[model samples]
Structure formats: structure tokens, C-alpha cells
Target: MSKTIESIFKPHLKPKEVYQGGKNPPTSNGKKIYKLSSNENPLGQSPKATEALLKAAKHIDVYPDQTDIRLREALVKDFDGQLNANQFICGNSGSEIIDMLLRAFVNEGDEVIYSNPCFLPYAVFSRWYGAKQVDVPLLNTTYDLDLEGILNAVTDKTKIIFLTSPNNPTGTYIPKSVLDDFFTRIPKDIVIVFDEVYRHFADAEDYISGLPYVTEGHNVVAVNSFSKTYGLAGQRIGYCYTTQTIANYVRQIHKPFLLPITSIEAAIGALNDTDFIAETVKTVQVGRKYLTAEFDKLGIKYWPTQGNFFIIDPPLPEFEFTDMLMEQGIMVRPVSQFGAPGKVRITIGTQEANEALVKALKK
Candidate 1:
């Protein structure tokens, strides 16, 4: 008799539900469809990045630099040499870098802590690695991270703490004062993984990036991505900056040539196109302001956002509200899966897309 598939794999590896993002909406009667579901850049990729991608396509047969030296150099220059080139590690996406860190640090039955309704990958990956998940609930109504609750949840078993500033779905961020205090309280042996994929879009005066903690000799790993800010989502390039010790450990487990040559070139090109980055930030800011004003006029309540997206508590059921938007040829994400049932997350898109959304709501 053939062996069962489950029997062949590790017994601890039970069937797990994977996280799903927004789906592409179908065209309705030739109506224009705007996808505000996945938080993608509405203005599209930079021309310089496109040019670099096309140029690198000519050398598809060649392997990428295993060391990722050029991309690291560009990042160092991008930050004005605030970080060293040797401290960076490139991956397929920010998600991949998080997974790599998990693999490098977490052992079976070790506890991992994070806020609920956060980036679900934290929970999914923790379970995959046999780590105990300690999810501290966010503060009610405000949807802010409960720093005290998180600190109280810690124990000797805790291995890593995942923090997403300007967090996904809710878009609320940890202020500098809160983070500074929280960092002081956290145990030194426990690793802190700061997912800052949305860092570029944040404009709040109190907001702070995690890079400073890494530079200050804390056990912090700050993950970033070219996907959102650079409009190179399709290229799938992400990276992290940390101390040499942690960076070395993550690099040891990484496979060579994981990044494509085109992706590397595209990221470098995106870095060089400073004007494009500025434009994307401005577009998101303008679109966000317009939507918030419309929401106010319509008496719609939404969480104030620092990221490019915001959460809304609709009068109708979350899924039902999403379906209504779908009928209007607009696709926004229902974020019940993020543990915030009855709320929907909408991406701030281009001027046309924002107007389309407001028009649909006005009907």
C-alpha cells in the first residue's frame, strides 16, 4: 500500500491555512476596473527601473552576484552611509527576509510575540517552525499596539518579537517615545524583527525607523522592500539591515543567486530615480487626503493612516461592503483574515482611482 502523504512529512507539520491577499476583480460589462485591494503603486514602475530591467534582460543567462555587493553599496549610499554594506542581506521580498530570520533564530517550542491583526505572516511562520505564538491584542478602538501588554507577555521562552510600524490593515504606528521605552524593556537576548516595508510612505512627525536600533547595538533586524515605494513589486526584491553577527547568520542559510540580475538592476535604478520615489510618496499623500475628506463628507469613520492604506468600519458587513464595491468596478480588501473582523482596508490609489472609489461610495 502507498504511504499517506502526511505520514511522509514531519508529524509536527500539520496542514495549515495560508494567508491570502486581494484577488483581481473581473471586468464588468466593459467597465473600468480599479484594484485598490493589494496596496500596489497606482502610478506604476519608474521609467529608469524599466530601462534597467530591459537592459539586464539581455543577460538573463548570467548569474547574479552571489555577494549582492552592488545592491548593498547602493543601499549604503542611499542611506548616506548610515549603514555599512556588509550589514545588508538581500532576499526575494521582505516576507522572505522575515522567514529567513525565523529559520536562523527560532527553535521548536520557542515563543514568538506580536500584536494581533498584524501582518499574518508572523503567525503563519511561527506555527510552521513549531514556535508558540503569543499574540497580544491591540488597544481597542484606537487599534494601536499595546506595548505594555507585549512587555507583560514576555517570558524566558520568547525568541523573537515581531513589530510592524504603520502596521498593515490598520496603518497605525508606534511613536518614537513608545518604541524607545519598549526597546529598553525588551530582553537583550531576544531578537526583534522590525517589518518596515511601508516605511517610505509614512510622514507622521513621531514616526521612527528601526534602523537606529540596529546601529545602537540592539539585536534588531530591520526589513525593507523595493516592492511598494519603488513600484518594483513585480521584481520581488527585499532586504534587511542588522549587525554583522546577525547578518552573517542569515547569510549562512541563504542560497546563492536567490535574486535575479534584473531585480538587482531594477532596485539600483529605482534608487537612482529619486524623483520617482518622491512622486510616488506625493501621489499617495494626495490620494489619502482626498479619500479622508470624502469619507468625512459621507460620515464614514476610518482610522487615521500613516501608510498608503487605511482601515474603515463600514455600516454593512465587511464582506458585503466589499461585494458592493466590487459591483461598482472597484476592488478593496476585506481584512477579516487579519483578525479585525467587520473592517475593510482600502489602498490609496492614483487620483482617478480615488475619485472612482468616492464616486462608487456616493451612489
Candidate 2:
């Protein structure tokens, strides 16, 4: 009764592609590195979060609480202290939560809806979990969510719908009205997840956070990360808010102790760092305006984005543009993998980095 290991492996198993991200060019080689990529917090982490990390570092030998009690309490307070532990689930990364959501609800032949040219990171998870990822095309370079098109794509097999307001790379958002209507039309049985990793950066009047629906008994989950705004990308701590029942289901399928002890402590520290959050918002808004102005002056076409990153179609092809930027010791994401062969995504960095990018583009 000896079965070969290859036969036992899931037949649907497909080799995954290696994810390419922005690189922090080392300071050597006498080249000045200006990294306006990877949508990271250019200013760095909050002092409070940094202090908390240092303090927590002393307990390196001990295992962290698997329940992530402290981080949950911090999330409660951050959400006005109205919700409790059951409403939340922390993960090693927002990417991990994406994997958990698909694994918990999606099945073979079940459909999952998402925007094309979005956080391609999710594609790896959705495909690996056996859910057929139904990609909806973006309207323009920004990929303003095509609500009507997505609605038409849904069917009985659709198990999950994802909305990344102020969507990745493109930085375009679905209006609140469109979102409300989608919520009304979609069957409540289907799980909806609002990936709001850049929520703090979005101040557009049309942009709306999906937390209110979570409180309204809608089968919705709000997934976010401490990486971008809180500067915890390396720590990889993210949390999800949803109904208790879904949280319980996620727990059953979720890998145990997913949030390492240090990550939990770092997230708790990040929550209390309100000043750092405020500073990050102010910096991005200021830099965003500046970036848009540069685009306007150069007559470059771009979408108005409420999030920290946005897509732009320069006069040249992105592959060549990206290579040029890399040679200059600057990193920007080219959108070929996200389905846009000609456009590139740029993240707002510090003032200095932004200015350098502007000059680089001008040349």
C-alpha cells in the first residue's frame, strides 16, 4: 500500500512564481539610492513602536501568547474599544490573512472575485488554495473598481469577493455609494473582505472604510496591516476584524501561533504610536500633492489616488523605465505582472526621495 510521494501531493499543485519587490540598494558602489518603491513608510516606525520593540527584545527566549491577547486589546482600543477579542485575528502578515480567508471558505470550483492589476500577492494565495480567481479588468490605469462588471461576474460558485479600496499600484478607490450598493446586491452568504492596508492614507471623500458593515452583521472582514503606515513590514503583523463565527472558522483552519511573539509586541507598540501615524499621513498627503504636480507639469497621465501609491503611464514602456530607474539606484514597481504592460507603480517616499524621483523622471 505504498503510494509515491508525488501521487499523494495535490494534483492541482502548481509551482508558484517568485515575487519580486523593491530593493534597497546598498550604500556602496558610490551610487546614491533613492527608493520610491514598495509602498513603505519612508519616515520609518514610530518612536513608541521602536521603544516597544526594544523592550520586547529582552524576552527573546520566551514564546509569545498564541492568542495575541495584548495585540487584540490594543486593537479594541484603537477601534474606540467597542469590540473585543473575538472580533479580531492577528497574522504574521496581511498576506497570511489573505491565505487564511481563501482556505477557510473557498473550495475547489468555488469562485473568488478580485480586481486585476491589484495586489498580485493575493493571486499566489488564492490560486494555491484552490479557488478560481476571477479577475475583473481595471477601468483605466488607476483601475477604478468596475462595480457593475464585478457584480455581473458573480454567480452561485462565487464564495468570496474582495475590495481593496484605494486599490494597490493604481491607488484608485471605489466610491462609498458604489460599495454600499454592492453590499446590498451581493448575497450575505458570500464572504466579502475589505483589504484596507492603506486606509490611513486615503482621505478622499469617496473613500469609505468597511468596518461599519462588520458591525452590521454583514459577512464582511476588514483586513489590514501594520506594514505600510506603521512601518512594520519586516515584522509582518496584521489583523482582521470580522464576525465571531468567521473568526472561529478561521481559527480552525489557521496555522497556530502565526503571529510570532515579537510581532505581537511590535503591533501593540505601533497601535499606541498615534503621533507617528499622524506624521505619516501628513507626509504622504504633502508628497502626494507634490507628485501629482510633477505629473501634471510633465503632462504625464495618472489617476488621482487617495492611497500612498499610484500608477502612471510615462511616455516610455515600463520595462525600460524600470530598468533606467534601477540603474540610477532608484526602485519603482513595473505593472507587467499586474496585467498592465506599459504602466508603473510609484510609492510616495520621504521628501528627499520624492524630489529625487521627480528629477530622475525629468531626465
Q: TM-score winner among the candidates?
A: 1
Where does the lowest 10-residue lDDT sum fall in candidate 1?
4-13
- Candidate 2 lDDT, 25-63, residue by residue in tens: 566478787777789998888788888888888987976
User: How do all models score by TM-score?
Assistant: 0.97, 0.95
Give the runs in model 1 whose Cα sits over 4 Å from its true position.
1-5
lDDT of 1 by residue, 119-238 (tens): 888998888888999999899799888998999999999999998888998999989999999988999899999989899889999999998898998999999999898999888899
Model 1 pairs in collision: none
lDDT of 2: 0.83
